[model samples]
Target chain A: MPKGKDTALMSWKEVPFGCYILESGNSVKFKTGDWRSFRPVLDKEKCIKCGQCYIMCPDMSYNQDEEGYYIVDLTYCKGCGICASVCPKGAITMVVEEV
Target chain B: MLKELAKFKGFSAKNLPKEEPFAPGHRACQGCGEVLALRLALKALGMNVIAVSATGCMEIISSPFPYTSWRVPWIHIAFENAAAVASGVEAALKVLKRKGRFPKNRRVDVVVFAGDGGTGDIGLQALSGALERGHDFVYICLDNEAYMNTGVQRSGCTPYGAMTTTSPPGKKSFGQMTWKKNVPAIAAAHGIPYVATATPAFFLDLMNKVKKAALVNGPAYVHVYAPCPTGWGSKGEDSIRLAKLAVETRIFPLYEVIEGKYYITRKITKPKPVEEYLKLQRRFRHLTEEHIREIQQRVDAEYERLLRLAECL
Candidate 1:
């Protein structure tokens, strides 16, 4: 976890189980058997690089590399469908990854 | 000694769990009713539960990046797939339980939450599929009339003669020309184990219905009338009171459909005029006297039908 950063990507298992904590806390710990990650697969053939998926993602999970093509960070992606919904062309799909 | 023993055995508010599964700090609008409904639903479901929310106001506001309002295991799927996701979760849990993957002594309940646009419109098909499959889960529709998350667009659940982005009232036409879809009746037609219509104004009754739905082994549906202050153009603090007036005016009746039987939970002995409910919100400000009369007649007819169903029960 980075210092002074309120939100950091961590496994769900690191958080204490059955404890209710508000989202305002700077640090988060997950519980064992609770961590799940969602990976975004972008088809290069269908990629128009419109940046709609990158812009619409609420989690800011996607980023543009040196080539200007968008790539998603699976470690932090919550798998909400703002990207796919806003994508004019069918370009994005959320795939659940094994923890 | 006997009095002290009885006191210990009796129910006390303090004995109830104080954990809030829906924590504060989400970006729900100042007076968003869906947020209140989520809070109350969490209070009913407790900590040992997972919530599947559809794409709507609650999902967007509460789940922006590193912030999430939910204290429970929450999943946000597509706009019209909350019930389907909940069904998958329940099925997975069942398989895990059978395979000893989950603790045999403990069980987890699944709840699906969706807004009116997602539930009454886009998600109805998926919801019906889940109910028909007899998935052991609770599906709650926090109906705020229109698609408030999408800039107050009119949805099928919007009431007649109400202004919306899509159903704007004009010189030649009334707002939302069509009447609101009868979603509770549609759920009742599924012949599910339990179905009920509730509102935030009646907190105890709403919680009771949620508890009953949770205990049922098969599919259960709870439609909650959540007043939207921003969409309805009303005072934010008046959300709960307006919900109460909706029931009093007989516009949105409080009732339950259990085991193919209809039970009217809150019956207005002397129903107030429909104007009393409409006059509170600016969305219905364009309704003329004739339109108000028409709306009242429709409300009376619906109330009569509900009364008939109760009688048959």
Candidate 2:
């Protein structure tokens, strides 16, 4: 588990139990990329730049470069293969990660 | 086919908002479908909304002590009163807005996120009251089928013939004897403006329904089909596959009701047998061939009934 924001001033043991609000942007510190066992590699040659991969990625890990094609951010990608499944051109393939 | 698929053509990561209302790092199980649905729904709802979460998996996991995954203003209510709390929030916000306490240009959406136990059984009365009173809020029931947080006890939404802690199968009886409750249909029966069924397997559809539900004037209900790998005894990685199978098999049809009018979003052209779905979970592992056939018949009948409802409008 990632350390929450402002742990010095507030702690789980100290806070009163009930309904209370937390500051925004606390969830960004947690990275889910380690959950990936299979990573998706994009073949630019077969890619149509149709943006289907970008749309279907649940984690929003796809980033569009200056050339207008999308790139996957491996830091947060969970390797769900949704992009590859939804890709009409079959440009993306899921490959097993070498241990 | 091209024209039919064109509706989703331009959607890209660039189009999505930069803000992350519900953050990661809370203690949700890996590949948890309920968390996935919550993420998509919160993404669609954006930063200007307030959420009331009922006591369940999400509530327990997201807000454990000092750490919280929510970025927006969220309230953790009881297991059966999220709708009531949200209604109160909406009413208070309305009066505050009238008194010029808030900016005239701003609109704060009141939303509820409850599990199947909270919505289908414990929270039904409060939910019905909120909807009947015409509260301007979006109520989302992330149905994971049973009381997952409380050691997998069977709830009202638990489907027939599935084994749970309280509904184990034996020589005299099969698991949970009743069918899954149709919470969305009950919501529509209240004449709410929007009532939709969504699954995390279809991210875009779930996002669209959440957005629509947020914008409705009266009460809106979005019943999301969230599969629980822990309780269902399935591989964590196969969570999305299990959800997709549920949709493809037409066992949990993806549809919506707009002011009593039904619309089937993703039509199952050639529905697969329910056994394909049942085989994915260990809860149904004890089911015999005869039991599977019975489940298939039940699914087919339900699908036909949904089709008829869609045709009525």
Candidate 3:
């Protein structure tokens, strides 16, 4: 389903008043990853693919690859270090950004 | 560092599912406790839910102009009628499903997220009405204990002896003279299916309570201890620490009432003094040692009463 700008393109009268989007799952337009001061780097060799990062991330930044290994989607990751803190095997490391 | 290590049990993270209905960005302050609670609550509720938010901090921050942070179907209505709006939505969904207008497989959970002022003071009537009518929805009170969105005014849930903008400490008076309202007990009195108190510091306990509330057949109430750094005069980073201390000091115990039976979910085995919780925030700085002792005694008495209720039940 079309969302964001397309929904905004629709007639104002047609859509419900008060900033109501016509469809769900439309938060992609807002990039919040810039809010991060630290970025998480995964040590794939030691990851064990427990899917801990995928499950525990508050931002839902982790996705499973075709081989079922979890990868961080940095587009929306605020780098809260929750995934790192929750990783039992210590496979994830948080790197401070130079900026 | 050891304290942080002991606070989190890593294994519990494995149980959480990766679905972000409440996205980051928009306009929450750094380390916002209410936003954290909303994130976790939405995580537990998943994508198949409709959230009705009252006109407060969450609503203002999430819905501005043509932008929204909610990835799910969300509504921002008046401050006092989120429950009413949710009840309408649930009723519409029910009738639509029964009349075959909606797909048979479609199951949408209706949830209301309101602040302490909205839930405990302004919206109390609508909430009570909905709960009494037994709407199949969850009413979550993000109890930050004051009117945070409107310049940090005192509310019904604001604890006794805390300084707010309106309840400022003066030469002749202390701040917020009355005790915090026992909202969970009020919800339980309606004989609802579930009523619980939770905090974002205890992720497992909070998520579990939210999940249970979402699945219950009747009205379910989950009061979350959402500490507001801006209102409480604490550092933004101390949000989680203050929340943990609130629980640890027995000021906000984790408990649930299922059909009038009380169950203390998390016990403070080695409880700290209320001052440990109060000293961190400037809101309580004006309080003297005598005032602190009074608050401590009140907390002890309330906790003991809760324990007795749990034991008797």
DockQ of each: 0.02, 0.26, 0.21
Q: Per-residue lDDT of B230-304 in model 1, one digit per residue for the tens?
A: 899986546766888999999999998878988899989999898988998999999999999999999999999
Tens-digit lDDT string for candidate 2 (B1-313):
1232235332234576556687656667655778878888888888899989999999887876456788888888899899999999999999888999988779889999999999999999999999999999999999999999999999999998999999999998799999999898889999878899999888778887788777767899999999888899987657777889999999889998877889999999898888888988999999999989988898999999999999977
Per-residue lDDT tens digits for candidate 3, residues A1-99, read: 887667674566666775556545455667778888888899888888887566545565788899867998888777667677657698898899667
TM-score of each: 0.74, 0.84, 0.82
- Name the TM-score of chain A in model 3: 0.78
Q: Write the per-residue lDDT of candidate 3 for residues B52-143, one digit (tens) a residue.
A: 99989999878665567888888789989999999999999999999999997877899999999999999999999999999899999999
TM-score of 1: 0.74
Which portions of model 1 miss their true places by more than 4 Å?
A1-99, B1-16
Candidate 2 collision pairs:
none
For every candidate, C-alpha RMSD to the true structure in Å:
16.8, 5.1, 7.0
Evaluate residue A25 in candidate 3 and report its C-alpha lDDT on the 0 to 100 scale: 49
